[model samples]
Target chain A: MTACVIMGSGNIGTDLMYKVLRSYTLDLRALVGIDPDSEGLHRAADMGVDTSASGVKWVIDNADSINLVFEATSAGIHRSHAPEYERLGITAIDLTPARIGPSVVPGVNLKDHLEAPNVNLITCGGQATTPIVAAICRAASVPYAEIISTVASNSAGPGTRANIDEFTETTSACLEEVGGAGIGKAIMILNPADPPIMMRNTVYCGLADGYDPERVVESIVQTVDNVRTYVPGYQLKRAPVFENGPFATPGGVVQTRVVVLLEVSGAADFLPAYAGNLDIMTAAAVRVGEALGAARTGGRT
Target chain B: MTAAFRLTDSTLRDGSHAIRHQFTVDQVRAVVRGLDRAGVEVIEVAHGDGLGGSSFNYGFSRIDEMDLIRAAVDEADNARIAVLLLPGIGTKDDLVHAANIGASVARIATHSTEADISHQHMALAKDLGMETVGFLMLSHMVASGDLLDQAKRMESYGADAVYVVDSAGAMTIRDTMERISMLKHGLDCGVGLHAHNNLSLAVANSLAAIGEGIDQVDGCLIGLGAGAGNCPTEILVAACDKAGYETGIDLTELLDVATDVVRPLSPNQGVIDRDGLMLGYAGVYGSFLLHAKRAAEVYGVACDDILLELGRRGIVGGQEDMIIDVALELRQAADSSDAPR
Candidate 1:
């Protein structure tokens, strides 16, 4: 049996560990935890998985035939520990936003690190949205792209806060992969004061020479639909379209708008074909996982 | 004193308004160098809140707080390195970490009503041997008397200076002068100003505060910060120099940095204007301006309407900054309105 270890049982830790345990692809080895909370430990124990309170020690002690070590620890925590797993012949998949290893969004820049022993799963937000960014870049056929993500303050945990730079860089890089060239920018915000709301990402595409807005919107919609099929939480709340022309709600209530404009720049260099660009990103991420023999941890058929 | 005044630049930390919190280390470092060369006395290089130990998008330096500070301090040998730490989100340990990593000063900022938060952090920062300043954001929400009380408490809490931050970037020049005068009378510590350009009044209000004998002024290069941003550091330095006040900044170098450094990273045509003024009118804070901008982008509504609507939604009068949320709602509304009809 191919054994898999999930190091650092925090928020993403708990969710991802359960997914790994339920997967038919690998045998669970240990659910290492650092939280003193007995409830989380008890839940892991109930799942019939061995649990440890020590962070790095637990991983060091139990390393044998481990096919993959999933590091869901806080950002930066995995940076020092990830190389250790790799040295021990264990393939490490880091879900934390720390720049521990190459960022992998499955569909975006997955191919870049396919052969590497370590991979960073990036942030949950990046995993869910970069593909759309890639697609939008392709459809708009633009020179530059900027992806902005807004999350309700309370919903964004420490992971989102500590590694803010890494989160933005990874997202930007992933989009750059699809835009095929030129610079990319990523912005992420958390509203600790706002009510609980879904994580949202807005992609603003700027081309060397502006393109057709209607075609860009259509391509963005199709690309988002394709990505959502693969990444469950990757729903397109507001695809690339014009906002606030005729439709809007009253002064208050939950209002969210995502606008995409196809304005030209100095020259008409590289144009985006949204669908094709998204295809490249999405396919790249999955391809990386497949190369590493990663199976559906969240119960893939 | 016929001398110049001191200024801190919040461009990177506050600019999180325009793009979310997605700045790279290269960009942040550039901002630091620009602010420093322009002769800002202190460069606040990270989140106005404490450093996060987890994954966050918009905040201070993304790299380790220590690393960002050390790098900035190395580049800006003459400028003091300051960081903002909000209460509840930051611990005493983080404050200590900031000091160890070369942070010369720490600003303990809390909502006007939540003065206790900054007070606790201020005490801790002082104990750690770091210069501490207390900032009461959203000063509009609290009465002058209450603000005076908070400033006095901050003075007692060991804060070297007390700042009345128009966190919403909405304070008028008159309002800023009045608050500075009140705080100066009520508190024993030096008074400082941190203004947001939401109402196109950051410079005016900051200047007003300086005229009232406020000790320090907070600004950004070309006001490239949250919402419309803060007072321009170069402008403040020049004004203080011209006014014969001791700003302790090199006006010529600052202008060079603004032209050569800041403009390349995030270019701005000019200072905060119409929309920013409306934000002040709506009583929205700068912290929420980015969110308002995002909501305008998302919902496709006029940013002015979103700001007004947020004001109507009881969002205008809270310690919490939720401008992005209001923007998100506007975006969602815009989407639904256009649905397949």
Candidate 2:
């Protein structure tokens, strides 16, 4: 069985590789890592994985059955190399926010990518919230929705700046797909978590023109339950409440309050979700990958 | 005395925390435009974490050194463009870039009492021909006398002015006045005050600082800043006007900036709303407002209770963003059915 090859070795790379290794039940044939940092490469070596300090192309030659590659390098590096990696037979899963590939979230569009060559993971925030978005879409069968994820500023990292635009776009796309609609807004907030906080996501859903607000709220709550099944960190922060008044809705049209709390694992000092939360998001990704693989196999054979 | 105050808007830089660096160029331009119209003298737009910007914590909204200076150039053509360059996050090259691109002032900020770090930025600013202001965060962390010593040290290092930043928004008017008086008496340079409204005393404390002879009034328009926000430029300007202080700004435009600009850009968040008042009463620092708000969203708790609860948790000083952690803890405690509600 061919497992996705994860490249780069930063926070995203390290976590994604570990999750892929743990969840898939099969050993990743070529978990190649290309990093100049000796410490990172040493860590990968210690993990009993292949380490490639040379160019990415050199690593490509080592594997014959590369099903997919996950690129978790910095934004600048990912932007320059991700597209080329996609062109190769290996389907690239970019966890970095460089926005070089089509944005993807597991369970929402895992089946769509099994045949495709490459895809990008939207963001830690989006990955945590999109299922709820999809669940909202599934429940309401609405025409539109919006998601506002306000995170602790400490949670906003290098990948955040590198992929701000994509975060908005991917979130919007997920909302549209979930609602089976078009043109939704997704706002990501990076708040300075003083005592620092575990990362969390908030979703705001708006229905098609003149739809019942009650129905939308009911559907979103139901979606949250489904999401909580796999993502335990998810909690319904605020039950869907109707906020209709001046300045309630930014655009003056969408009047809905659907807030969900995601209590992710945090460092001991509560300095937001550092490497520990990265591990949780990565683990979720692997779970989705396995589901995708099963669905692909089940559908094909 | 002109009876007006100058505003140094930092929404593009400090406010980037709320959005993480995902702010669009359009958003940056929009924020700058509002601040400019509000008669803000200096608009600080760039990476709050500094020029080197870490990948894990840097917000995309952080304009590169040159780009940030350039983007803010048009909006602040008349207003002096300032960039905050953290010592470790920036280099001499960043100072040089800021100076070349028309940055009139470089607020060289460092942790309060950290003289070496302040001196490094101050020296770099002087070399680049930029007005070198030394900002000491969490000014109340030490006694007024101790701060006076640091202020004198900063002046000796070539700092044009010494800025007392209430990073924790924890100071009272007495604290501000005492700090300003000390700086005025001990240092040859001018004194400045950057107040946080976490205690709802930002305006009062800033006025008191000015009364004690602080020359520069650092503010953000409509208080669109980190924590409860800095003293609202309009409110501060009006108070200064009534008090007959000279700030070299138009009071009318400052009011207009609040009404038309900051109020709209950050419509519901960080305003002096009821929640903001609660935060102040609770002695929660300014930076924690957004996090508390997020926690409120996450825990299904009323946003009103977050600050008070956080305050009770002994989270104070510059640790404003930790309110969310407290909120999450409260949630966990409530969920376990073990602790008292």
Candidate 3:
């Protein structure tokens, strides 16, 4: 079994712990957090996984045993710890928006960056929308694309609040790099409601040329299915709405435009199921970790 | 009368929404000249949604916002130019670039409950040698305590001032008094107010805020802003003069800006039509008035119903895409209801 440690035993780390526990390839090593009184650490210890309150210090001390590490802490925390993981020869799957490594959306470009020392799972909005944008671009030429990611206010913790700038910058960069859009704009909104709203994304793309509605629709649906293998709750709200005419975008005007709306419901492991915004990050990280683990152990999927 | 509060004119920034983000360089130059002549201390210039707001979601600005900012800076003889930026829509680079162009003030805005998101931008503005103002949009949605907490977060981030913005124009005089007083007492930073005229209470709410010793307030010439418009700068100055408060502005010159420069452009600047009234009634965002009207015509739904439902869903700004989606859903509902039951 390939040994692994999940760092930062917060909501994301604990939820990731449950995901790794269910993994058949990755061998759970320990859950590390800075707070000794954290509920996430207590729950992990109760579930028979080793728990450490020493944070990155524990990972540095126990580096010989762990094959991989998941950085679930804030971007600033991950930035300082990523080099240690690299020096220890442990592959780091970064959940924060720290762009120390090339961004990897498993459905889009995970295979290309499997050998990198650290790989960033861009923001939740990036993981959820980048694959669809990439799929549509493969079917046509997309010049400009804009995405708005809305999440429940109740699901956004203080960490998420402080990193709103990082969220938009990382997500927008992912769209242009992996999704093949010439220009990308990202906006995030946190909605406060009684029963929290599921993570919903609205994507508007200005197709420049070489496009067909039937082909683009098929490509998008296929990409959704591919992502659903890891995240079962990811889905398109309905058929994408297409319009033919002059569409005014910041980059320029496009004669053909496509509007796509989708939603994600979480697996309800550590956080409420409405927090699919947080869930997609852990789910994508697990998929990448499993791929790296299987390759290390020489196990067949 | 002693001028008690610092006045910032937003005819260029917010008024861009009234003209669909199509402000020309000449228009900006002429308007800034007028405001500068009228002794307007700080004049704001940017796209309706702030810097870098031109996109597929919000309609594209006719000219680049940076060039317009440069124009405003060049034309204003005494008034310093200010620009607005929402964190998710505009980045720190935009702030740095604006400062390089001689703009001296940056108003970093966010939804009332989400001021934590504006911390970095506020700090960045402070570092850029510009005055930083933490602008909380849609302040009426949260109570005084909640608003105070958000304002304090902005203050801790190095914001020099914090503005309680009623983006929906839904705040009553009492609501205005409560939030302004809380911010004034709770934080070390100065407090400001940005009121809209949707409820026909823009002047009343500004008066309430001024009565609480607000350090700064926003107004647009002749109230030429989105939906029902903002507190008319001409009228606000006149009211300050009458209330025995000091505004230090030459009211006659401001009236010249309203009567000569703006009125010719937006003839219906102060008209509160059905759609405009629905914004205040349903507590919908003032900017959504245009988006909802476009989507309503496209989906064949009543504009008022669209605004009411968006208000019910409690969508703050930054969710402009939801306006079209909700309108389409309302259309589908209408179609289904018309079908055989």
TM-score of each: 0.57, 0.60, 0.96
Q: What is each candidate's fraction of native interface contacts (fnat)?
A: 0.00, 0.00, 0.65
For model 2, what is the C-alpha lDDT against the true structure? 0.61
CAPRI-style docking class of model 3 based on DockQ: medium
- Candidate number with the higher TM-score (2 or 3): 3
Residue A298 in candidate 3, Cα distance off native in Å: 3.4
Score chain B of each candidate by TM-score.
0.86, 0.79, 0.98
Top lDDT model = 3
Give, for candidate 2 chain B, the lowest lDDT window spanning 10 residues: B54-63
Tens-digit lDDT string for candidate 2 (B232-305): 77677778768877666667766665676456666754456766677556655555666567668866777767
Worst 10 residues of 3 chain B by lDDT: B322-331
Q: lDDT scores for all predictions?
A: 0.61, 0.61, 0.89
